[model samples]
Each structure stands twice: as structure tokens, then as C-alpha cells.
Target: MAEDTLVRVEHLAKKFCRDLKTSLWYGVQDLGAEFVGKKKEEDIQLRNKEFWAVRDINFELKRGECLGLIGRNGAGKSTLLKMLNGLIKPDKGRIEMYGRIGALIELGSGFNPILTGRENIYNNGSVLGLNKKEIDGLLEEIIDFSEMEKFIDTPVQYYSSGMKVRLGFSVAAHMKPDVLILDEVLAVGDSGFKIKSFNKINEIMRDAAVIFVSHSMPHIANITNKVLLMENGVVDYYGENITDGIERYFGLFAGDKERVEYNEFATIEDMKVYASAKYADDPSRKLPAIDYRDPIRIDLDLKLKPNVEWFHIKLQITDKDLKIVGIYDSFQFQEAIKNDRDLHHLKITIPNSIFIDGEYSITVFIQQRDPINSKWNLLAVYRYWRKFNMKASAGLGYVPAVVYLPGQCEVV
Candidate 1:
């Protein structure tokens, strides 16, 4: 390990048995082997009903680095974090730590339920190797940062989930440990507090090594210099290319089939996305990649019920996170919809897209306006109707915004 390295993991692996009885039996066998001063080959092999929660994971975090651990649920991210925090022992491999560690792996994990918040702060400070006078100096600051000064004397059992998160993160933030391990505890706090917490994390990253586990890509991209993507208890991708890591993480999700809601008065029979002369005709490509800001053309074939006339259409574009980025309405263009026959073919063109480099999906909505009330009735909704990928025009590094608009600078 380097002198500046605060956390180092080497081929770390851990396994668990599904059945309790079998787990106990395996434990006993492992104990017997240990007592006899002999290593069992089976220790490295998976038995029946046993699986590796985290396997062969290796990473090193030096003093001013933050590592993003991201993956789908049940991908062994939490398990790996627990091992690094010493909450659980690894079945194999080694973890080397150099200095004091602070971890917020679970909400209210280190708190005493019966103890008052004030007392818990002192207790946590003591656990972090801070003396009484040191903790006294930081007590008020911690309370203020947590925004729980009013409830400082209240018992922790009465704290809500958000309160617990605030208190827990406050202590961890102020402790200033050499290595910080944070799970998704920040997700529980309110928007203001989350913002505050990220700011604090930014401050800490300059002085300590951080291992942050989060499902939010924006958060991962914002804080982590490098990323480790896990899948099925193993390393799927690990590198400093945060964009590539995020793209691979999005690729793990199989695009959901089009979902209909409300009245199924219309159905999208076929949908195709086109960029320039290249027609997205490959069935194997889940999301066809296109150059950024390329003119996009969407062709949709819809089958509508009889008597449905003068209906409006809406196209909603969403990023890989399923967050709505932009929307286009047929009413804006005043494009008349001719429902003379039951089937209809509509082509929508985007002269130039402003979306940044990332994955995006489209959702379609069909509605009818009541002439008397002037209110629109949702006729159909096709969720996750189409998906596409946009490649960056040039390597401009990381632009946090969703859309990239061309701009000119003027020097006067």
C-alpha cells in the first residue's frame, strides 16, 4: 500500500449461505479446519445454496479520492461496503486501513435507541477516538449542522427516518476521519439537507478518502473521481471514466415494454427512430446510438378506435434516470390529425436536438379534447415507447446539465 492510500482492498470476497442450518454447519466446518491449523479447499468454493455476495473486488483510495460504488439492487454493493467498514469479515482477501474511519452505512446504525441525541453524539465522538473536551468543542457545531438543536435532548427512538439521517450524517461529517464510507443515507434527508450534505462531502473529499455507494448517477458523477460498477457479486466495470461507467450502468437495464394507462383507446403499432440517413433498423441494438444534436425523426404507426376525432399528441423525452427532460406537443404545431381511417401514420421531426451526451427514452400520450368543457381526456399513454443513445459531439469533459446549447462568448 502507498503511504497516501487510506483504503486498500485486494481480491476481497465474501459469501453467505441461503439456509441458516447449512450456514451454521459450514461455520462449524470452517472452525474445525481453523482449529486443526489446516485450510479447507472448500472454503474457497461455493457449496449448495451458498453464493458470493461480493467476489474478487479490488480498489485503492488515496487521501484525496472519492470512489463511487454503483449498481442495481442486490448487486453486492452494500455487502462490499460492510466489509470495508469492518461490520462484516470477508471470507477471503485483505483490507488494509491506515487511519481513523467514519461510516454511515445504515441510518441510525451507530446510535443508541434509548440514548438522547446529545449523549449519542458524545458516544459517537468517543467511538471516533475524540476525547471529552474535543467532543465538547464540536457538540454545538454538530447540532447546528444537523438542524436538530430543538431535539438534541430527545431520545433517538423517537427520531424519524429523516431526523436519523440528519443526525447520523452530521456526526460523520464533523468527525473528519481519514476514510469515509457513506451508503445511500443522504437519500432520506430533505432537499435542503441533501444539498448541505453534498456540500460537506465536497469539503471532506479534499482531505479524506471516500467510498460512496449510490444508485443516483448524477450524485455518482458529481462526487466520484472513479467508479466501480458491480453486478452479481462481481466487478462488472471499474475505472476512472465516469461517463463510460454510467453508460454501462444504464445498459444493464433492459428497456421495459410499452405500457398503456387509462383508456386504451389507441395503441402504437410500430415506432422507429431515425438520425440523418441512418435508419435505426437493427433489432439487436437495444438503444441505437446517434451523434449529439443530430436531426431526429420519429415515425409512429397508431391504431385508433372508431369515433375518435381531433385528438392531440404529446411526446415526452426522458433521460436514463426516467426524469422528464423535455416535452413536445402537437398543439404547439397545430398539426391536424386526420382520423379518417382506423390506422394512422405520423412523422415527427426535431430540426436540431439540444440534448447532451447520454441515454434518453420517449413516451407518447394521446388525448382528446371535449368541445363543450375544453378539457383534454387522456385517451392513451405509451410509457417507455422508444429509447436512443446520443454520443458527444466533442470531448468537453463533464457537463452536469441535461441539455447542451451552443453559446457564444463576447469580450467587451
Candidate 2:
């Protein structure tokens, strides 16, 4: 590895056994082989019930670079990160890292449960190669940033998940490691703390290499200069183009883009839908993108389980940031009544397609009103599909929203 290259990974792979007994037995065999100073080639070969957790992955990170790792759950992201951080060894290939590394991989991952928060800070700082003087110089700032002043002396076991994340991130941020690795643990914090964490991440990215893993596309777009899309334990897409990588991820779920048919005590099914009015003429045709001049029409085929009375449905659209930009409710809009019918069809239309250039997703919610307070009760929810991308207009530099309505021209 060169001075500029902070982290380098080549042909990295990891495998795991499906059966716990088999895994433990294999571990024992490998230990015995090591004890006898004998090489076991069968250790690398997959047997009855085993699968690759991560396979043939390669990437490099340089100084001042933030590489975004985007993928669905169980795509071997955490395994790869564990390998890079020396928490686990790769089954094959090499990883060379050149500096002090700071990692916040999991919630409450490194903190000692019985230790005070203050002690944990000092402990983690020491682990990052900071001396006592250096830790003292940054102690106050770390406490202030974590917002754990009142509970700094309290045992970490009593701290909430959010408190641990705040303290963990603050310590990692201040350690000034040559490389930083962060997982999707920031969701445990409140919005205010999330903003502070993002700010600190930006501050660290000025000179350090960062590997950020998040399902949030907006966070990846805003913070990272490059993106890596993972699927089925392999790097499906790795490039500098964020949009392209996001599109590839969206495309993965677009085929039959619907959620589970039954969850909890209810059943919702066959939510075949359309994106814009143009597709309504041929309802069987695939949903198309909404043209700025056309109207947005979403057709839903809802079927309720027997014995269910009245239910309300809401349509909401969200940007990459996961912010709700457009929302409409069946009850609020006087669309339909909940009946005992097993089959129901709905068509929702927006008068104008007024969004700027960006990818958006449609989320549907089924609810019933509470008998006591008449408040809406959610029953089922689904993100129908997310292939909608409002094309950019020629003059607009960067439209910052899903839909921007022109206001009245009365400047008094």
C-alpha cells in the first residue's frame, strides 16, 4: 500500500456454514490441523451446507475519499467490514490497511457494558493510538458532541441505544484515524443528533478515508464521492457515478416490486399499479415514468381478508432522502368506503406532475379507524415500486425537491 492509499482489498472472500453443528465441528478440525502443523486443503472447499458470505470482492480507498456501500440486507456488507477491520479473517485474498482505523460498525459494539461512558471514551481513544495527553485535549469536545455530559459518568449498560451511538460516533470522529468505517447505526438517534453526526462525518472526510454503509440513498449521495452496490455477496456495481449505482439497486427490486402478501393477521395482495396517466389506456402495460406535463395516476387492486370492515388507504411518495414529498389518503380525499368486499380497485390521480429530476418511490398504506377515538389505524403497508425518475428540465440547475409548485406572482 502507498501513502495515499489508506485501504486496499483484493479478491477478498468469506464463507459460513448453514448448520451450527457442522460449523463448530469444522472449527475443531481446523484447530486440530493447526496444532499438528498440517495444511488442510479441504478447509477452503465448501461442503454439504455452506455458502459464501462474501466472494471475490476488490476495491481501494485513498485519502479524503468516502466510499459508499449500498445493498439490501444480508448482502455480506458487515462481513466485509469485519474483515477490513481485522475482526475476522478473509477466507481468500489480501487486505492491506495503512493507518489508525476508527470503526463504529454496530450499536454498542465496542463499549464495555459495566464501564462508565467516560471510561469507555478513554479506552476507545487509547485503542486508537491516542496518548493520555491527546485524549485529555479532546475529552471535553467528545463529551459535548455526544450530548452525554449528564450521563458521562454513568455506566454504559444504563445508556440508551442512541446514547451509545452518539458517544461511539463522537469518539471515532475525534480520534482522527487515517480510515473510518461506519455502518447504518445512525438511525437509532433523533433527527437533531443525526444532523450533528452528518456534520461530524463531513468534517472527518476532509482528510481521512471513509467506508460508509447505509441503505439510505440520499445519505450516500450527499456524503460519498463513489458508490458500490452489492448483491448476493458480490459487488454488482462499483463506480464513481452515484446515480448509476442507485439505478442499478432500484432495478433489482423493480421486478415484481411488491412486499409480502400476508403479514401479522391481515392479507393484502395483487397490487398491480401504474405510474402515470399515459399507462392507463393499456393497464396491462408496465408502469411508465411520469412526464412533467402529464398527470400522476396510480391504480391499486386491493383485496382485504374476510371479516374486515372499513379501511383507509394512503399514497405517499418519497425522495432519495426518505422524506415524504407527496401524500394522499383515501379517507381524507373521500375516495372510497371500507366494505366487506373481498376485491376493491382504486385509481389515484395527481393533477400535475410537478417534480424535478430525481428518483422517487410510492408507498401505500392501509388503515382502519379506531372505534373509540376515530383515529386511523394502520393495517398494511407496501412500497409498490421505485422506478419513477422525473426528468430534468433544461434550465434548472438542481431541483432540490420532488415537486416544486410555482407560487402566485404577487410581490408587494
Candidate 3:
């Protein structure tokens, strides 16, 4: 481990039951019973099998640096976080950390649902190594920060889910440990609270190294000074910023430079992603950047396999904060087609009138369907947020707000 490393993880692995073999056996057995009548209770037994959730992964967190963790669902982010916090032991590998740590690994991992908010505060604080006097000094500030003052004496069960998260985060935030690990806790609570919570996080970020896991790339880009991408149990890429990590993530499955000829679904058999709509060229410049009161365009060129339905596509624009700005769907508001064709050239153009002045980005989704209701196809997705002329608040002397709406008056 480097002297600058605050935490180091090497050859870590965790496994879980996957593809219940017994379920398959029973399911197969049931197929025979369809011809024989009701399944005989005495003859059937259920079975489950185990699989690796994470394997042979390795990485290090430098002091005062922000590291990101990203993978598809079930790729073991939460499992890795648990291992980092010493809440769970890895089936393989070792992790070493230097110093007092604070983690809000999940929304509410250490709380006692039955305890009063007041009691839980002390309990959690004590666990974090605060003496009773120290806890006392910080109690009121925690309650105030959480905005759960009214419910301080109430049982935590009586609190709403947001309240619980606020309380938990408030405690963790006040502890000010040497290292902090934040999972996707930002997804919880109301928008206003989320903003407040993020501000608090930024405060601690000045000194503590933060390990963040989120599906929200925009946040990852803005907050993380560095990144490490994990794929198939390996540290696929690690860099000075989030963009490099994201490109590495896309490359693992997309592999834009390679030609893949095999696909189980005919709808996607010929679907080769020559270049992403977001990354028409270099991905470093491809991050989403929507200027307020300006138009944005997403062009798509695709060749589809036969036996595919007319596809519906959706393009969503969001502010840098990862809030939705506008949604454009093919079936709802863009170009359309009636036949199952081999190729398509389509573009979605967003007029400047829709958004409030802010920094924003784009995400696209596509599915197959008819005019009435299109059943979604799973293969299409693209996200851009960090790279852009898309932001800048139209500050390029284009006050020109999100909309002109003509016929203006001269200040009555």
C-alpha cells in the first residue's frame, strides 16, 4: 500500500446463492406433473445454488481523494461498502484502513427502529466513539440539522422514512471521521433535504476522503476528484476524474471498437454501437451540457434485425443536479415509423423554451412497440453530464432566458 493510501482493498470477493438449481429441478419436475396431475407434496424438494457476487477486486483510496464505485445492479456495490465498514467480511481478500471512519453505507444501516429518536442518537453516537458529554454537546445540532426536532422524543418508528435517513445522516455527518463512505443515500428524503444534505457532504469533503457509490453519474462527476471503475471483479480503470471511469464502464460491455456478431434477440442481433450519441467522437468532450434557453440535439443512426417492432425512443434532459428538465419520447413527440425496418436515422431536438436557467445533461432510452403502447426493449441507454458546452447558464451573453415569449414591455 502507498503511504498516501487511506484504505486499500486487495483480492476481495463475496458470493451468494444464484440460479436455484433445486428450483430448476422442481420446475422441471413440475413440467412432468402437468401431464400427471397436481404435484405430489412428498416427491418434491427445493434447491438453491450459490454464485459470486463480487470477485478478486482490488483498489486503494488516497487521502483526501474522492473515489467512485459504479456497476450494473447486483454488481456488488453495497456488498463492497459493507466490507469496507467492517460490517461484513469478504469471502476472499484483505482490506486495511488508517483512522476513525464514518459510513452511511445504506440509508439506515445502524438505527434501531424501536428506539426513540433521542435514544438512537446517543446509541449511534456512542458506537462512533463519542463520549456522553461529546454526544450531549452535539445532540441539539444533530436534531436541528436533521430537521427532526419535533420528533426527537418520539419513537423512530413513528418517524417517516426521510426523517430516519436525515437523523442517521446527521449523526454520521457530525462525527467527522478521517474517512467517509457514502452509498446512494442521496436518493432518499425530499429534494430540499437532499440539497441540504449534499451541502453538508461538501463541507466534510474538504478534508476527508470520500468513497461514493451512485447510479447518478452527474453527481459522481462533480464531486469525485478521482475515480476507479470496477467490472467483472477487477479494477478496470482508475483515474483523476469521473469521465475516464465512466468511459471504461461503457467499454466493458459496449466495446465500441469491436464487432460482435452474436446476440440472442434478433431485435438486437445487428445492433452495433459504432459510436455513442453522447460520444460521437472522444468521450472526454461528450459529457452533457445544456445551456438554458437553447436547443439540444441527439442524433441516432441504427440498423435493426428483422422481427423487431417499431421502436419507441425516449430522451430525457436533466439539470446538473440530476433533476429532470424535459422528456421527449418517440411515440409521444418525435419522428415515427410504421414498418419494422433494417435501419433508422432519427434525431431529437429540444427547443430552448423548456428549462429554467441551469447546468444540465442528457440520457436516452429506446424500446420497441406500436402506436398505442410500446413494450420497452432493454438494450438502449446513454448518459452524458460532465463534458459540455451544455451548461454555462446561457451565460455566453445569452440572458435570453429559457424562453423569449416576445411582446415584452419596457418595465412598467
Candidate 4:
């Protein structure tokens, strides 16, 4: 490990049994072996009913750095977090930390449900290694941050999920540990509380190494400079360039790209994308890459089932983090298609580019008109149907905004 490293994990692995009976039997065997002074066999290999929840994981975190973990559900993120928080032990490998660690893994985990909120605060503080006098000084601050003063004396068992998360996060952040591990606790809070929580995290970011796990791409992209993308129980990508990491994360859903589905109502296919310079000779050629100064175009071929009355097409652009940055619908160009046809072709064009440097995903949507009101309603979705990269020189300078808005300036 590096001298400045706060957290280092090497080849850590964890496994679980699939069948309850088999797990119980294995537990009994292990306990009997321990009782008889016999060494238990190593758990490095899987048994008949066992599977690795997290395998061969490795990463390091330095002081004042944030590492973001991203993956789909059941991708071993929660399992790894449990191991980091010392709530569970790995079957193989080791994890070493050089600093005091504060973790907000499961909401209200350290709180005694039967205890009053005020008492739980002191208990949680003590668990975090704070003395009685130290907790007394921080008690009011924690209550204030949680906004639960009115219910501070009430039993924690009666608190709502949002209230519990607020209190839990307040304690973890205020404790000022050398390392912080947060796992989707923000997703439980409301929008207002989320904003406050983010503010508090930013305030303490300079003092601690943070590990964050979130499904929201925007939050991950905005909070962390380094990323670790995980796949089925293994590291897929780990690096400093968060944008490329995000791109690889989104690329996991490649099956959604340029694929068409057929149903009783309609079929959409032959999706294509192109970019062109202003007044270029060939306006529809596929672009190797996108320049912010060039225009973009899309073409789609579709067929409507008999008895279909009206339909709509929508184009959406998402960034490397899978956050929607731009959306333009055919309805904005014209009213719903009223003519009934067995087959139809559509061409959509944007005359100017508003993008900055990054990978982009283009999603296409096909919708059916509401039977009663005639408004467009989504019926099919094709996400990441096309992807394109924007050159770093797309803009003269680095633009922090998602898409640059072109406008004419006039002095009144």
C-alpha cells in the first residue's frame, strides 16, 4: 500500500450458500470443528450450493480522494460495502485501513430501535469512539442537522425511513472520521434533505477519503473523481477518468443498442445516425466522431400494425453517466402522424451541435396515441441505440455544462 493510502483491499472474496438447509449444516460443521479445537477448512473454494458474492476485488483509496462504485443490482456492491464496514468477514484475502472509518452502510444500523432518538444518538456516538463529553458537545449539532428535534425524545422504532437516514448521515458526517463509506443512504432522503446531505459531504471532503456507491449517474459523476465499475462479483474497470468509467458502465447494456422489437402494434428498425459540417457535400454520412460545430441527423424506418391510428418518435441524448442531457421529440416538429400506412420512413435533423467533449448515448422512442385524448404515450424504448464520441476540441475551452446553448446576444 502507498504511504498516503487510507484504504487498501487485496483479492477480497465472500461467498454465500444458496440453500438454507445446506447453510445451516455447514454452520454446524464449522462450529463443531471450532469446539473440538480442529482447524476449519479454508473457504476459498465454493461448495455445491455456494456462490461467490464478491470475488478477487482490489482497490486503494488515498487521503482526500473519493472512489465511486457503480453497477447494476446484484452486482456485489452491497456485499463489498458490508465487508468494508467490518459487518462481515471475507472468505479470502484481506482489507487494510490506516485511519478511523465511519460507515453509513444500512440506515439506522447502530441505533437501538427501542431507545429514544436522543439516547440512540449518544449510543451511536459512543460506538464511533466518542466519549460522553465529546458526544454532549456534538449532540445538538446532530439533532439540528437531522431536523428531528421535535421527535428527538421519541423512540427510534417509530421514526420514518427518511428521518432515520437523516439522523444516521448526520452522525456519520459529524464524527469526522479519516475514511467515510456511504452506500445509497441518500436515496432514502427527500430532495431537500439530499441537497443538505450533499452540502455537508462537500464541507468535509477535504479531510477524509470517501467511498460512495450509487445508481444515479449524475450523482456519481458530480461527486467522485475516480471510479470503480464492477461486474458479476469482479472489478470491470478502475481508473481516474470517471467519464470513461461511466462509458464502460453504460456499455454493459449493449443489447439495447440499435435493436428492434416486434409486437402486436408496431415494429421499429433500421436506426441510423450521422453528423455533417455546415454545407457539407454529403450530409448523411456516418460520422466517426462528433464536433460541437457540426450538425447531427437520424433516420428511422418503421411499420405500423393494422388499426393503428397515430404514433410519435422521440430522440434523447444522454451523457457518459447515462443522465439525459437533451431530448427532442417529433411532436415538437409536427403533430402526430394521422395517415395510416403499413410502412413509414422518418428523417430527423439538428442543424447545430450543442455538445461538449464526452461520450453520448442516443435513445429512440416509439409511442402510440392515447385512444381517448390522442396524446402520445410511450409503447417502446430503445436505449443506447447509437453512441458517439465528442472531440475534446469540440469547444474552444472546457465547458462544465452538459450541452452548450447557442444564442445571439443583443444589447438593449
Best by lDDT: 1
lDDT of each: 0.87, 0.80, 0.66, 0.80
Clashes by residue pair, model 2 = none
Residue ranges of candidate 2 with Cα displaced over 4 Å: 34-43, 254-286, 297-324, 327-351, 356-389, 393-401, 404-412
lDDT tens digits, residue span 1-412, model 1: 5789988899999999999999999999888888997865344788899998999999888998999999999999999999888899888999998888999999899999999999999999999999999999999999999999999999999999999999999999899789989999889999999999999999998999999999888889888899999999999999999988887998898756667655468888889987444535656656676776677789999888887877888999998777899898998888548678877888888877888887788889988878799788888898877887776647864556788887889999
Please give the lDDT score at residue 47 for candidate 2: 66
Report the C-alpha lDDT of model 4 over 1-412, residue by residue, as the tens digit: 5777899999899889999999999778767867997733353467789998899999999887899999888899999999998998887888998767878988888889999999988887788789999999988999999999999999999999999999889888888788888999789999999989887777777888899999877688777878999999999999887777776886686433455443446666577666444424544534346567676777888777666777788888887656788898877788887546667888878777678776687877878767688676666677677876665443243344677677799999
Model 4 TM:
0.79
Show model 3 residue runs off by greater than 4 Å. 1-4, 19-48, 250-412
The list of candidate 4 runs beyond 4 A from truth reads: 1-3, 31-43, 255-271, 276-289, 300-347, 356-402, 406-412
TM-score of 2: 0.75
Native-to-model Cα distance after best TM-score fit, residue 78 in candidate 3, in Å: 0.7
Q: TM-scores of all models? A: 0.92, 0.75, 0.59, 0.79
Candidate 1, run of 10 with poorest lDDT: 275-284
Name the weakest run of 10 consecutive residues (lDDT summed) in model 3. Answer: 267-276
The C-alpha local distance difference test score for the whole of candidate 3 amounts to 0.66
